[model samples]
Target: MRLTTIGFDADDTLWQNEQFFRVTEERFADLLTDYAESKHLKQRLLEAEMRNLKLYGFGIKGFTLSMIETALDVTAGKVPTSTIATIMEIGRELLQHPIEPLAHAAETLETLSGRYRLVLVTKGDLFDQERKLAQSGLGDFFDGVEIVSDKTVETYVRVFNRHGDGPDKSMMVGNSLKSDVIPAIRAGGWGVFVPHALTWAFEREEPPVNEPRFREVPDLGALATVLAEIEST
Candidate 1:
């Protein structure tokens, strides 16, 4: 069947996201330089983030807390209060980072807005996601918006069904294979991988090698053409 619903991931897919997090992490490592090396500190912070995901979930707030926890751990609870404040400040900066829409992001959305039922299926802090969308000036192009905590097969099934025909007639396009592509394809929808320059370590996964519904494009600029090919077939 022809695709009807198109779900786009918000973070690195629509706008700049991971780069801010990387910069904040560098600042975080600098704050703990006295206690640990930068490389070791980064590893510890990643561990803290993974361990705290269930408790804190995703986004800047959780990431901030993880930095605090890692600092305390590395310093044996002796990380200075001033340093903690600095880390928090860095996190705040990340929260307030300007929303930069990636190249072709706007025009792609503009092209597909009327032709398909476009829904933003993104996962992150609710307020931050909302803020980015508002600032993007492309919110009007989406028929629906889903700021989910995580993307899963069930999430795709429900989102596609609610916004359009069903998972069978839907496509989820984004930069992360694990979150945006894999689950959507598993849920009986088309999964398009548009790899960003950087992806979170935890979100990396092997692509579905033989999945006919899976398509990888260089960027959003080619998204419309891929959809056209899918429709023709």
Candidate 2:
């Protein structure tokens, strides 16, 4: 089927995102250096994030809370209030970090905007995602926006159906194979993996082997060509 809609993942796919989180994590490790070794601290923080995902969901607020939780755990509930305040301040800074569109992001979106239905299907803190999109200067290109809590097969099916034709006639492009590619493919859409350096471990997964609908590009610069090939197939 001809591709009618294209769904793009926002963070790390179109703009710099996970890099901020990596920096914050480094600062977090430094904060708890006296309590635990850097490796142990990072492991504990990852555990806290995983455990809290159900309660906190994704985004800076949840990450801040996870840092606090990790700090308290490592310190036996004795982590100083001042350190907690510092983490909160850094988290706030992260929330306000400037949105730098990736190389070729804008041009690629613009190239495909008029020809195909473009939808921003990202998962994060709704207000923060909205703020980033507003600041990104790319929001006007999208025919629809979906700041979802998570991406799943059902999510893609519903989003593509609502915004364009349907999943079979849609393509999802993003940095994480686990969330952005695999599920979209399972929903009967084309899944294009555009990798990023700082992807969260939880979002990493081996690409589907021998999958006719799965494609991977080094960056968004090569995306238009891939789309063209997919359409021809």
RMSD to true structure for each model, in Å: 0.7, 0.8
TM-score of each: 0.99, 0.98
Q: Encode model 1's per-residue lDDT on 120-223: one tens digit a residue.
A: 99987899889999998889999999998889999999999999999999999999999999999999999999999989998999999799999999999999
lDDT digits (tens) for residues 132-199 of candidate 2? 99999999999999998889899999999999898999999999999999999999999999989888
Error of 2 at 161 (Å): 1.0
TM-score of 2: 0.98
User: Given candidate 1, what's the lDDT at residue 185?
Assistant: 96
Model 1: how far residue 35 lies from native, Å: 0.7
- Candidate 1 wrong stretches, greater than 4 Å: none
Task: Specify the poorest-scoring 10-residue window by lDDT in model 2.
Answer: 224-233
lDDT of each: 0.93, 0.93
